[model samples]
Target: MTFGGLPTRWEPPGASRGVALVAPGRSYPPTAPLLDFTRVALLQHGFTVQQIWWDSLTRGEEEPEAWVRRHVAAAHAREDADRVLVVGKSLGTLAAPYAAERGLDAIWLTPLLTDPSVAEAVGANAGRQLLVGGLADALWDASVARELEEGGCQVLAVPDADHGMGTRGAVRTAEIHLEVARAVEAFLAGAAAGAGA
Candidate 1:
């Protein structure tokens, strides 16, 4: 499948409640553990998942914000759903501004909190937003995450986890993954309930 004219991997469930757009990082593709598991979680939550494949060789040269705006806008134009959720990670977190501007629900994995604009966007979003990041990630700022949480965003700050949310041992890494997955599921459930209300 193709989304916003970019190659994509589409997974549509039998009865979808909405659409979930999965945007990957600069080096991390959708097939990565974090993103792939996110796709599975969204599917389990009855969302049609569209995992966009970025052409880093070409589109990566464009400004981060601009690239996200163009592709996400195209996705919105093509998708016909009452609800839309954006699941982004790292470079993909640039979509924060666009998602905020459009009032879309989002789950940001390892978001680039180092970018003031991205942090501001997350804080400004009135719609449901889930931010998951690790304390050990250079781009993850604990203070910023706390501020966003105070502003009503759901946050999962993992201690000792890296940019990939991986901890020291294999067992710990798996535990972190489970924790993240549970957070995503709970967040989506709340969003769904809020929408129905």
Candidate 2:
């Protein structure tokens, strides 16, 4: 499906618990390992997934936050789901404020903690939020993560993992992936229960 001329990949389960809108990083497409695993996890959890694709080169003159908000909001409106969840990575974390504004649950992978706006937005979310970041990532700030956790957001900080959440060894990297995936599942389970409540 396409929303506002932006390409999207939609997968709707037979009976959806809700909608999961995936926003990828500037260089990361939905097909990347982190996002692909997230898509599968959401599908397994009975969400209708909508993954948006975009080229940063073509973003034109709009501000990063404004562009992200416009496209994300457009896609959210197009989905028209009663319940919504947002999963964003890296640059896509720019949409944090929008998701927070709508009180939607969200999972942020490798969020841009270096950006004050992004960190602030993530901290402001009233709904359930899961934030995963690598300790080795230059953009990941431990202090900020601690503060966000204190504010009620769930956080998973992987040791020896870089910006791509990859460790020095393949085996360890795979283990990290599994760990992140399990965290996602647990977080989604909690979100599902909260929604049912």
Candidate 3:
């Protein structure tokens, strides 16, 4: 799909309660194995995945916040989408919440939250959102994680791994898949249930 002059890939349509928007990292394509693995994981947990590639942002070329608004509008067009969830890895995380600000829920993976000025551009309450990352991720620090939590997001720290959580290749493990699936299921269900409260 083309949104705001950018290209995005949508997963083959499947059974899902909502639409999931995944923004991939700079070093890899949307179809990279790690992203593919994560996409499948989200599918196994009943999410239909759509990916937006913003690799240019890392090179100081693209404006992620602007891209985010376009994709969020795209997700909103999906039938029966009461809520859209924006999920991102690394640089994409900086943009994901920008969409969330427009009323979609967002999930950040090994995110690096930049200055408040940028965060404010995303939305007033944008920083107060869910974030997930591995404990061993070098891209993030504890203080940043705490700031996100303080802003009101529920942060889930994956143990013993880096940004993509490949410690011993957990991506291929049935146990790890189950764990991630459960966490996502619970998080979405809870978020849905709490939408008005």
Candidate 4:
């Protein structure tokens, strides 16, 4: 996916105090049919999701930073989204921190790298971050996870799961989404309350 491009699909929720940006992994289409499940889950949880422009065949063309910023801006403009949250899968996870830098809370699911360098580059400093992954995910290591946590971010590790959290089997499907929604909701609630106080 290139920067300055548009999301292939945009799903709005019944009501939202914030916006959630969704980024798909490499080689995945923005309109991938399977994403219907994810979209449904987010909507069910009362989130307004700004979709990604995923292009699987457009190999190595992803400009992560620019794409993330553009979508966030567009979503805010369109919905008057007061709070922004990021949800990224695989390569998308790499972009989540970028959103966080611009005042959004983030959730990175199965990022491909455990590189703290990446975290530094994105300015994921001392707060406003969340990372979720399975123990089987080679992209992220314990050290990297620890680095994020030490930086004041929240982290969740799934047992026996892989990069996508789908490699394990059916049992993880609802569990992963549920965990993601719950975490994000809690973060949003806390952030909102903090701001109001």
Strongest candidate by TM-score: 2
Candidate 4 residue spans exceeding 4 A from truth: 1-15, 28-46, 59-79, 121-127, 172-197
Residue 9, candidate 4: Cα error in Å is: 5.9
Q: Write the per-residue lDDT of candidate 2 for residues 1-197, one digit (tens) a residue.
A: 67566546656566887898899999988878888888888988889889978788888998998888887898898886788999998888899999988888999999998899988988888889999999999999989999999999999999789989998799999999888999999998888787679
Q: Candidate 2 regions off by >4 Å?
A: 2-8
Candidate 2 lDDT: 0.88
Candidate 3 lDDT over residue span 1-197, tens digit each: 76566545444355565667777665655666545666666565556677775546444554665565455455556536654677766666666546655655676666765445334433345423566666677765656667667767777766665666547665544454455555555666566557537
Residue 21 error for model 1, in Å? 1.0
lDDT of candidate 1 over 1-197, digit per residue (tens): 76466546555567788998888898998888988888888887788888777766677477878997787778777898888899999988999999999898999999999999999999988888999999999999999999999999999999989999997799999999999999998997887788689
**Per-model C-alpha lDDT, please?**
0.88, 0.88, 0.60, 0.61
Taking all chains together, the TM-score of candidate 2 against the true structure is 0.93
Model 3: lDDT of residue 7: 48
lDDT of 4 by residue, 103-159 (tens): 566666676555554566434544376677777778867677777677677777766
Candidate 1 TM-score, true structure as reference? 0.92
Model 4's C-alpha root-mean-square deviation from the true structure amounts to 4.9
Clashes of each: 0, 0, 0, 1
Question: Residue 149 of model 4: what lDDT?
Answer: 75
> What's the true lDDT of residue 31 in model 4?
48
Candidate 1 residue pairs in backbone clash: none
